[model samples]
Target: MSHSIAIIGASGYTGAELIRLLATHPSFEIKALAANSKAGQSLGAVFPHLRHLDLPDLVTWEEIDFDAIDLCFCALPHKTSQEVISKLPKTVKIVDLSADFRLRDPEDYRKWYGNAHGATEMQEEAVYGLTEFYREAIAEARLVAGTGCNAATGQYILRPLIERDLIDLDEIILDLQCGVSGAGRSLKENLLHAELSEGTNAYAVGGTHRHLGEFDQEFSALAGRPVEIQFTPHLGPFNRGILATAYVRGEAEAVLEALQQAYAEEPFVVVLPMGETPSTHHVRGSNFVHIGVVADRRPGRVIVVAALDNLCKGSSGQALQNANLMLGVDETAGLMLAPCFP
Candidate 1:
């Protein structure tokens, strides 16, 4: 029952996370690890925390034998992922953790990423990797595109409301606070310890954040019309989770009822009791989502909030969930670990 696996961009945060989770997977075997720049280095040298695991030394993608691999996870940067993935053998199934294939249309890709897509044909075949809603499509597809962490957080709170016709499409506003890790493992002056600690600031204000494209595509499709929402994202001082609060015009009782119904059978999504909200601390390091709904003092105003690990459920964990479906294995395998708490 072992499914051979390989990981490109194995030196990145999402790549490290995939390795961490797969270490305990009963049916997945890590056959190869690729990180071009870090090629010839042991995975331990790249990530000391994983130094204890017996894994392959890093190698360039070209050195790996695709014939021996069942599936591959690509954790490269946006434009780079499409370029590398396009050259990979079609025989290998792929789970891409990049912004490259999330937007199905080539035009939308250009609008958000500011570059023409390198692989439009493959984009057409890739399924959006929101395991809860696109479960069936993912099971049958060869490539699955992981959503933006911000996008996934917002959707978890808003999708059901939109699907059940319970909210005003034009009046949705999502305010999110994301841990510094969501920005990736890359180095930047703004992310320095002195500059980022003990403070919070909002970035991508006024609807310019790229994840809005996902919100537009997904919500519009569910509503059968054009739907646009105001989204503002903030950078928090911590290092692991995302807390997204959505403001919408709807009846609290109905909104809560719809969310409960939508996730009633979903293993990873938890709908809290009415008037009860969730905290990022409760869902950190796990592939679980906690959602809460509350009625505002002003009637007809409803606030829905959701929390989850950006690196886990928001990206790598989500990729693994879809990979299990694509591989015909149990959907929850290796992913039911309880959230890490204080």
Candidate 2:
């Protein structure tokens, strides 16, 4: 039985990415696409790169018949997703690709987003959609919230070590570099070709990045106490991908063993051989995360690196992976496409 799916914000980068991957998905069918601004236009018109696939024309959210849809991917902007999702049918399983529902505490949401959560009841039920960490919960959830791309990258490298108690809790530092597409498909002066084309710079410095809320929530839970890490994100000139380098004090062999043991059974996470670090190019355009660990010259220090396509494994791919679990389909069914190579 094929599930009928709807994409609520179908004109954006992540929305297009979802369509690209789901075009070949075996268990789900794209039944509707909603884009308020681009309504009545064909998906090909909005995203020329996706012209190769057959998909529905863009429609306004009000035009979609939620009664006929089994699952919905809410790809709307922050603060907007909660408002949109609040009005959807209770029976519709939703995977939100926004910052709205990722934080569990409403206060935290307001702290990071600067406003109260419009839908607190639903927020309480939303399972954080870090597929590897929250698989069982996601499988049983009616609403799943996708992680921040930067948050996902950092967690993939540190979560396992933190869980195994193999690293210094207070000494973890995450330095991440992400492609511009992670900013979304909106217009901005800084994102223009003239400003972002020839150079790269870091933003949200000094432990101020929003994704830190996620790091605090998840890492704290794993350690059974409050855990904070120094996190900084850099904007790279590239189009897509995220490379996170984590510095910590731990035995290199133990860190390697912890990561390998944690992701050994995971379909989407690949723990590369010891002493071999991953590159963003290696996992480009695929629903895969490549992680590598190596020893630092200084004893009791190690560097853990993780690479993933910010749009794919970090967002849409992760969403689909959770959707598969929620919908009772094979987790790896439509995600077998190999990463693109240069």
Candidate 3:
């Protein structure tokens, strides 16, 4: 029997991507969709791209009877997500695509987000949903907190090296180029086509971006100390990917070997040959992540590059992957399609 599911915030990009993936999943059925503002409208009306799928019309959250849902994907915004998720029935599994429960400490959540965590008790059991590194814990978790797209891409490049103690942590730097969609479906003067297209500008410069909190938490926890990296994200003219270039103090060969050994058997992460760099176009619209490494001309320096679709392996695709593990289904199910190319 197919596991029945509910998708809250179905009108957004990540939510729509979840519907796109779950539409073809063999053992999952989307039984409800909630987009309060778009309530009573057909999914087709909100997102014409998904018009062909036989999906439930968007409804308000209060209208759904949670008893029928075997799993739920909470794609709502930060504060909103915690509020809604706190009210869910404990029996239903949840995969939260927001930043609400990603941090293990309520104090860190408050320090970074500037507000108290609405669901402090819930944070106690929310597994970090990076999939590859947290697979075992995710399989046993009822609530999984999805990592930020930028955070995930950077981790794919740095986590292994940190785990192996192969790199100088104090000198790590991550420079990222991200798609505008990572900003979300909301309206912003800067995101307008006429303004964003044909141009590239760096936001979150000088270390103020919210995703830095995730990096600090994950990397620090891995290194058994506070490890901070200089991170700056540039908004590219493209629509759906993140390309991160990390500069670390390590030998090129050692960095390559660490990355290769870590993700060799993983289904979703691929490491390119030494000296070869990956492009966002290669992993666009797919659940795959491609990583590359190169030795800098200066001794004791190396560069690692990682690319992935911000919407896929980054957010919604990640949420679906965690949902699969929680449901005891194949981790690759409904997410094995090849990337879209020109």
Candidate 4:
């Protein structure tokens, strides 16, 4: 029952994470590790923490034998993912952890990413990888697109409300605080320790963030109309997790009821008791989502908050979840590890 797997971007944060999770996986074997820049380097050299896993050394994607891999997790950056995945063997199932195939329309992809999609044919069949709602499709999909960590956090709180008509569509506002790791393993002057510690600043203001394409596509489709939400994302000082606070117009009881009902059977999503709020600390390093609902002081207003590890549940862990379904493994396989907490 072992599924041979390969990671195309093995030197990045998400790639390291996939190796960490798959290290203890019951049915998945890491067959190849690809990182073009780090080619010929051992996984231990690029990632000291993973030195104990005995995984394959990093290599160029072009050198991989796709015939030997059952599923390939493409952890490359946006534009690069589409190009690499489009050229991958059609026999291998793929779980893409980039933003490449998330948007179904090439026009939407171009509008947000400022480039034409190189794999429109693949996009047409790529299933959205929000495992809670898209599980069935993912189980049957050959290519699955992992959602943005921020987008996943927001949708976890808002999707049920929108679907059940529990919230006012026009009044929905999402304010998120994301840890630095969500930016990936890339280096930037703004992310320097001295520059980011003990401070917080919002970026991508005025609906300019790329993840808005996800919200626009998902929310609008759920509501059967063009539903636009006011979303603002802030870069936090820490290294993991995402906390999203959603402001909406709705009856607290009804909204809470809808969320509780929506996630009642979901394994990874947890709906907390009313009046309790979640913290990014609780769900860090795990494929778990904690959601809390609180009634606002103003009548007809309620606040919904969700917390998850941007690296785990929000990305790599999410990619692994979909890969399991696509391979006919248990949905929660290799994903039951408890959250790391202080």
State the lDDT of candidate 2 residue by residue for 53-78, as single tens digits: 78889999999999999999999999
Q: What is the C-alpha lDDT of each candidate?
A: 0.96, 0.94, 0.95, 0.95
TM-score of each: 0.99, 0.99, 0.99, 0.99
Specify the highest-lDDT model's number.
1
Off by over 4 Å in 1: none
lDDT per residue (tens digit) for residues 7-120 in model 4: 999999999899999998999999999999999999999998888788888999999999999999999999999999989989999999999999999999999999998889
- The CA-based lDDT of model 3 is what? 0.95
* Deviation in Å, model 1, residue 315 alpha carbon: 0.3
Name the 10 consecutive residues with the lowest summed lDDT in model 3: 202-211
The TM-score of candidate 4 is 0.99
**What clash pairs does model 3 have?**
none
Q: How well does candidate 3 score on lDDT at residue 26?
A: 95
Model 3 Cα lDDT, one tens digit per residue, 257-342: 99999999999999999999999999998999999999999999999999999999999999999999999999999999899996
Candidate 4: residue 206 Cα off by (Å): 0.6
TM-score for model 1? Answer: 0.99
